[model samples]
Target: MKDINEPSTAPLVIADEPVNSEVIKTTTATAKNSSNKKSAGVSSQMQLLALAKNFVLDGGLVSSDKQMPLEERTQKRARIAALRKQENLEAIIKKSVNYCSATEFTNKADADWFSTFTELAEDVSNTTMQNLWAKILAGEISQPGSFSTKTLKVFRAMSITEAKLLAKACSLAVTEQTKRNIRIISGAYQTPGLLNFFSKNREQNITFSQFSLSYADLLILADNHLVFIQETESNPMNKSESFHFNFNGKPLTLTANKSSCVLKFYKFTPIGSELARLISDNIDDTYLQHLKSALSENFSIIEG
Candidate 1:
């Protein structure tokens, strides 16, 4: 009876120990789970921040998609892309324009006069047409008869056959007197009318010698007399433009005068001959000015 009242000591002891062990295990597991959950939350927040930074760098926004409706987000992305593309295109255009200006043709054969004619033909504005005719009259067109009568008529409402006849007639009209004038200055070939016009009853024996330069040949017509023809790149820098006249078998020193906006020629020493005097004494400044004015009246500046 005493043993029965004592209760089952072994079973109680085993039960109590098992219950305590289970509680301890449960508490440890719960603490580990909580720590893992916190770590995961922090990692997720860091990932979101990184994503947001990347979007901003790429000209976009974080949560932009979620905040805006699907249609609005799509439209916004398209607009941004379009704007970027437009800016790129504009930059390309500006670069191309600058290049064209710097590298345009310098030869008379490849002159801008012909291009003007083509542009006029495409769009026959009265002002443009008149300008084209003026340039032609100023002897700007190097190959007068290169285009067919049909082309000319289509270009200028004139009869093709009639225009061809007129061009031939003009070429034949070149006189011997003009040829003599051009021969005196450069011994180089010249059109008959041009020769006659330059030589017209002048006793002053003008002579020209050609010298090679970086951009174009320099025509030295006696000492103070020089014509510098340079091939300039169409760019604003005008890097292709340079001077070329010989001084003691070397090029003359060139210096730019910022105040006058003109280049000053200096230190020219031709080996054997004295430098030729400049033709300013006999030149008709007024007539030359008028000619330039007339030429400009016909030509219009076209954006490259």
Candidate 2:
């Protein structure tokens, strides 16, 4: 059916396809896709330009001599730098052994003892942990048999500062416990030097201040099961005096402050005595003689 020349209405052909709702939807989706591509391309170009600008401002994408020193800038090598893996860590630990024992170092014993606590090494990899570990180990080695499994457990339970305090206190029990024929004062064996050093005007007495422990320090030791402070029935009227004992061949004196406070005595537990053994064994003969004479002068046992 051909309309040759008379103004033929052959259904104005907009396109070859049907102009349905589906066609409209497809056209809209294609337009949206094209718009999204343009937006993405613009965003990508902006990011690239920003990166390039930043690079130019920051030493032109290269660290020149003025930007950084050669010491700070190590060149890359064909082989990568060693990574810090378990193997590397173990290697470092083993290598650290060489720096342990030297004559100049006071903690040589401690440095070597770290091997026993190798499991704790991870906690001490940094300087802070290393320092804490060194202090603890130093205390352990202060007395050969002082550090035990129990001590290790206790140390882990506390901070490094408290552990250091505990160790320092432990080292101060410098007298050995030995049976001696001495006078009993107030129903107890009293050392003469103990009384003499505590007498009035004690500053005139011989100086012995090497291992002076404060009330607080004693309390700390007591808490640790080393030594206990036994208050002898707090008597407000009773004033504890001071005395001196020969330590390190020096007449070291301890003067109890004259206070109407309750009298406290240091009673060494069995474990405390064990700790003392490693610190001092041989008592000075001269000091022993002095203690005996003082006790005799102070008390006389009356035969019933």
Best candidate according to lDDT: 2
TM-score of each: 0.17, 0.30
Model 2 lDDT tens row, 1-304? 1111222233433567645545534444444444324333333323333333322332222334344444333331111122222433455445544434444434335544455555444433333335444434444555444455554444445444444444444433223223111111111222225655575432221111223445676677667665656632223322334333333324433333343322223555555444333332333444334433433332221211
Q: Least lDDT summed over 10 consecutive residues: which range in candidate 1?
A: 271-280
Give the CA lDDT, 0 to 100, for residue 125 in model 2. Answer: 36
Clashes of 1: 14
lDDT of 1 at 196: 52
Instruction: Report the alpha-carbon TM-score of model 1 versus the true structure.
Output: 0.17
- Which candidate gets the maximum TM-score versus the true structure? 2
Worst 10 residues of 2 by lDDT: 179-188
Please write out the lDDT profile of model 1 over residues 1-304, one tens digit for every residue.
Answer: 0011111223212233333434433443444444324333333323333433323232233234335565666677677556654554344333334323344443354345455444434333233233333333222233343333333333355323323322222211111221211111111111234335465332211121111121111322212122222211111112223222322122222222111112212112221011121001223334323322322221211211
